[model samples]
Target: MAHVVSAMASETSPEDLTDLSLEQLLNLEVISASRLGQKSSQAPTSVSILTANDIRTFGWRTLAEALNSMRGLFTSNDRNYSYLGIRGFMRGGDYNSRILLMIDGQRMNENIYDGGYIAQEFMLDMDLVERIEYIPGSGSSIYGANAFLGMINVVTKQGKAIDGSQLAGEIGTFDTYKGRVSYGKTLKNGTDLLFSASHYDTAGVENLYFPGYDSPETNNGIAHKMDDERADRLFGKIKFEELTLSGGYVDRGRHVPTAAFDGIFNDPLFFTDDKQFFSNLKYEKALNENTSLLLKGFYQGYDYYGDQAYIVNDARVINHDEASGRWWGGEAQLTTHPFEGHRLIAGLEYQYDQRQRLLNYDLDPYLPYLESHRNGHRVEVYLQDDIQLLDDLVFSAGARLDYHHMLKNLQLNPRVGLIWSPLTNTQFKLLYSSTFRAPNAWERDYNAFGFVDNPLMREEQIKSYEAIAEWRSDSNLRLLGTLFYNDISQLLEGHLTGDADGNYALINAGRFHAYGGELEAEKRWSNGRLLKASYTYSLLTNENRHGAWANASPQNLFKLHYAEPLFDNYLSLGLESIFIDSRKNGLGGKVNGYELVNINLSSDKLIHGLDTSFGIYNVFDSHYQMLGVSENIDVLRMNGREFRLKFQLTF
Candidate 1:
């Protein structure tokens, strides 16, 4: 399967460059390291750029949804939360602390359980996002700790992109509804300001299943319980000359059931309301024609709560928990062209995080409360040199040193890359890098059953390498192919001990190796028709004994998308299909493979002075699960196939 896809990708024409307006393409810069003065093709890592157009084409409503279509990205069925695993390493429910998420260069990873939580509930609204830059390799050298797997940087929309006022609304399966409004203006002082707000609500589907667990006498039966989610978000951005400032707030709530054992269980209501606020201040000043300084500072906070009820040992238990944290950081960057054909970038960064958590139970009123607090400080210095060794060749090397106050350890990471343009329209690049992950607060302090914290947890490390070949064709066809491998060591895993609680303690006792290849192609027809396709194949193996562990990585993944304009200047149609190979859940249980199909039709035409659009998700009603949780007896499902429709207007 991989060979076939590779052969087909190689046959694509090599003269095509992306067809985009200068402004639109420049907007992609927010996520493009090349645009950020990081050597583009020569960066020592694998990176994918998702432009605003890509987001619009997918009709995504959130950052999690927007990332769903990527070759290596997947979301849990719950939709409200998602995880990104590079190669084959990934964390379970507590993903935020394992992966680092950034907005406009500010760290958003909050000190939580064992790692930072993504705070998916409070992430910027999709309408406020301009681009997403995904680096799928160890970024600890440049990003630190939570960036063990990779880093995702979300760049918000600027006022210049908002041509006028806009409004949109959507309704879908399971009584789902969403609405959004955006406004932008240029002040007399030449400063650009933009504001956006959006809301989403859903009474979700009843497709979940609890094995051997059923209420034969009830109308709701054993089918998964009904779930619901609500979210409200607001964002604002101001740009004045070389400085840009942006921030946002979000309030989100969700109700979910707990994992059950057999037919006897408790139906729990899970609620999470997250409030986040962030601001970024950047200054770009040129000291000379060849030297420039970039300064950035950001602060973010997460006020989060999780409330739920569950049945344990045939006894009903209710849990009310609150977790809150604040994170702030600043960076200073200097870029200098000290010699011909060479560029140097050096930067220093510092970040501080603090969190407080409490858990109380109503059923066991006499039980003592659980309280936990954590503080972390990170400081890093990095330098990169991009040398144009030849007219068509570039060599780049970089290094970073990081200090973690909690661990009292210092780490040094290094990266190297080479790019060669053997042909005018073709480029071949090679990259290698080493990155590390620090333990999260929860991972180090939480004392829950089934899990334990280790203060002496060694950092997780990965040595990754990739080779890519890309070609552009005159016929508007572009092809890109990459082969990659990753060696992971010092992974944090729970070592089961015969303790009274049957819990496992955290230890550096796991190792994993993974290799994969990906092929992507896009073609543009003269009549404005576009076709895009991608395929990914990966193989992963665990070298440690934990449980009934097997290959957890999906073996095959594919995507196809087609888009065309219709009805003159008023309408567009997009068709998409996604496929995933069968894989094991976190518990190492196998799941059946599935495919999904989606269709979207939109119009920008004026209908009675209103700009409107409508879209349908999961058009084929394919039954699929986005996430699975494994316990002693059963596997719990989170998401299933559903439908959605949306409309918008402007006054």
Candidate 2:
């Protein structure tokens, strides 16, 4: 398989420069790095791209799984929610508010929590993905907000790519089942349309034990039948001429087993429901060969509902949490290359948050504790210029200004980078960037889960400096290396306040400094073998509290992936592994280090238009404790082993 792909890549037309030096070939083409579509080799940051082929070959069931295999990035799961940790920077109470997730250049973060879900709760199913591009760095100068640490762009498969109806089904560990239905086509009038819907459910673990709830009446720290999950999703897209319309909907339900927040044990009253609906329209026109104009508009709606059984003085107090948000935004961009030495891209963006609502109540007693609704707006503009200073050097510089009602000052973020291509298939880069995250409505004024409101919360800021190098050797090998330093200020943290049973208050009183580096290597052989390996080393310390910051994820992470074909392309085997170092837990003790191994076997062309796959996760059934949020100071024991078998048919 590897050799086949390489042969196709090597078989390009000579007029297209396939036999020329790779550097000169790249020089003739440009990349959409940072949304400017500049030179690929001269992009101002480190990027990793994976296509649908890679996703299928690895049997990746979710986006989080694919991301965890990458260097300098990983995710944590407490069974209730999943959080993304990057560059040793995800704190105990953080909600993934610093990263930006986009589907075809449209934002996916909710308005209230501002979290970018990466697990089953993630918006799009893995089967619909065409490619995923991950750009790691501070990108506020180009994306405005929530692009603090990195950006993930998910591109869906076009209608022409599918060109027919498809059905896929799977049965997995813990009584899990999934099914998908899809249809796509290109009409005779040059119209393209695609649609897909998926349904999933799992019985989850039968029982879980938590040390915090150990007691005679509590079944000795065990909760029975408390873990279950279900979800439904739909997505569609239409493209005609220069216009495109796309939308999606996701609804998820997850049951909690840890009995967090002093909730009753072994009860059915602990669950959360997350729902989202979004749509976007885009149009582009080229005025001339050197100039283009584009416009986009989007609408998003979100709702969250949670039910928990709380024991207040031994009384059964049922808390019903509800929230909603409605947002609409528009953008205009102009790209031009007026002269030979320079290319420029500029854009203006505005968003109106028409409604943000939050309310919580005691359902049995019919008591309302808090209710708030707000309306706000934001405006931003940015410009970036890529200049060819010399034959071998490229310089890039940009800045963005944002205006928001809650902001004390207009935020201005700047980014600058220098790329040096001193030799063929080799590049070095130096980059400096700044980014900030605006306080959300919940962070500003909402009271829930023993958390008090702080309407005057300030924005958080980050500054970073990084160096990177890349080389593509002649012997079918690629190497990447990166080193970075980050300084953060005015971090929004939940502070304990008031009397003995004090409520958690939102405050901007935390600070941190971190440094990290990562190295990765890859090889593809003509004998149909592939290999990838990566290692990351990092250290993070809190300047305000004088302790390790977000140390739950390993500071030292190593990963490997190897794949090969067997039995004349009728079967393929993939092996994967990850090793992580020990880290501190919330209760002042060390969580042990652990390793995981996963294997997959897939068959293509076993029969006409039919494919199959079998996978085993946690091959050794290694047991580990997953850390928790600070406010909910309870660790969740993860599942031991899991297996899945899937089949697909196309007619």
All models, RMSD in angstroms: 5.9, 4.5
Give the TM-score of each candidate. 0.88, 0.93
The segments of candidate 1 whose C-alpha lies over 4 angstroms from its true place after superposition are: 1-46, 78-80, 113-122, 138-141, 206-209, 215-225, 260-268, 311-315, 356-366, 498-501, 525-528, 545-551, 586-588, 606-610, 632-641
Would you give me the overall lDDT of model 1? 0.64
**Model 2 per-residue lDDT tens digits across residues 414-503:** 888888989867889888888788988778877766888887788888898889999887766778899988888898887898747788
**lDDT over C-alpha atoms for residue 104 of model 1:** 65
Error in Å for residue 267 of model 1: 3.2
| Candidate 1: tens digits of C-alpha lDDT, residues 534-579 | 8887777776744223444677788788878788847767787878
- Candidate 2 TM-score versus the reference: 0.93
